[model samples]
Target: MTLHEDACRVLKEWRAPDGAQARLRDTYLAHLDAYGDGVWRSRREGHITASALVADPARRRVLLTLHPKVGLWLQTGGHCEPGDATLADAALREAVEESGIAGLELLPEPVWLDRHDVRCGGPDAWSVHFDVEYLAVAAPDAAERISAESLDLRWFPYDALPDRTDDAVRALVARAAAALG
Candidate 1:
């Protein structure tokens, strides 16, 4: 099946944690139906992005990247590529690419859905990212390397995430911690 088809199935099967999440799921499904491959990039007015909150095997820490554009300490993720087989694959690939960590395994289900605006350099001054977030467990003793996409990468203890992080990020971490337990 195509990535679009896989995404449709994944969203349909997903059991959202709240009414807000359920609404986001429905919006994502509608976006997929309307945009197809365009939903994967900023080429459209808004697109779907996949991200992951990566935790250590002990679930004590999460890896976050300092996004150059947004200047926020955020989870690893980005636009979906043609090589991606599913949204989960896209999230996992971003985690590995951004964190430079091996043996990261994503939780079978998504942990969060978020929609936010992003500024684009091109004619379109802005775009929206319908972000699907998953929880991934990194290998114990995993080492991290920062890529060009990020100004910095670090592992923060679940209770001590950076102050600059927003409430959504903190909530994701809390949910991930509970899932680990």
Candidate 2:
């Protein structure tokens, strides 16, 4: 199946946690229905993005990247690429690319859905990211390297994440921690 088809299939089968997630899921489905692959880029009014919360095998720490453009300490993720076979694959790819960590394994299902606005350079002043986030466990000996997409990459204790991290990130970490248990 095509990437758009695969994304639709994945979202249709995914079990969202609450009304907010359900709404985001529905919004993403609608976006796909309307825009197909165009929803993968910022050229559109909004797009679907995939992210992963990378946790250690013991779930005591998580890897977070300081996004250069957004300047926020957030999960590893980005715009879906044409080569991406599935949403989960996109999330995994982003995690590896941003964290430069090997042997990261994604959980079978997504852990969170978030919709946030972003500023893009073109005619559209801003775009919304319908973000799908997954939980991934890094290898026991996973070592991280900084990538061009990020200013820095670091492993933060689950209980002592950076102060700049937001509540949504904290929630994703909490959910990932529980899933790891």
Candidate 3:
């Protein structure tokens, strides 16, 4: 089987019976604009995800999402849609919609940048390449609700993330943290 097919099989087998995994499947399919298919290679189509490195200057914490599919801590973001003119605006919209914190201001400049492939979840026909853009600032309020797309949302200290999360996520956090400094 191709790597894409193998990853899909593994995701199917390893997925939990919890209803949340179904949300991942549905969300992936619903957001088809993020992916594309080829004969032998599945590739992540260009997409936008708005990420906020919400740093509480007083508390010195960064907001992060406990993502449902990847099952790892990550910044809040989602696939861009026709409604969004630029990827940065889409990032801000996703962050606010998911976090429910208003009065957020995107940093004048992107703090960090990176890319990753969508390897698993939904159909394993293609990849979604996320051109992740990082924005920084304090959250509007502590009262925030986790969206359906995320299992949980909370803040973490820069030093504590490596021990508390996966390596890939840790790396992204580190990238954002360095830019924050």
By lDDT, who's the top model here?
1
Q: How high is each candidate's TM-score?
A: 0.93, 0.93, 0.65
Candidates ranked by TM-score, best first? 1, 2, 3
User: Candidate 2, which segments miss by more than 4 Å at Cα?
Assistant: 122-124
| C-alpha lDDT score of every prediction, in listed order | 0.87, 0.86, 0.56
Q: For this target, which candidate reaches the highest TM-score against the unseen true structure? A: 1
> What's the TM for model 1?
0.93
Q: Which has the higher TM-score value, candidate number 1 or candidate number 2?
A: 1
The runs of at least 3 residues in candidate 3 whose Cα sits more than 4 Å from the true structure, single-residue gaps closed, are 1-48, 119-121, 139-141, 162-164
Candidate 2 colliding pairs, count? 0
lDDT tens readout by residue for model 1, 54-118: 89947488999998887789999988898998889999999999999888989988998888888
lDDT tens digits by residue: candidate 2, 1-181: 8878877888899988788788889988998898866447854688888999999957489999998877789999988898888889999999999898878899878999888888766555788888889998887788898899998899998889998888889989888887787
- Measured on C-alpha atoms, candidate 1 has an lDDT of 0.87
What is the TM-score (0 to 1) of candidate 3? 0.65
Cα misplacement distance, residue 95 of candidate 2 (Å): 0.9
Identify the superior model by lDDT, candidate 2 or candidate 3.
2
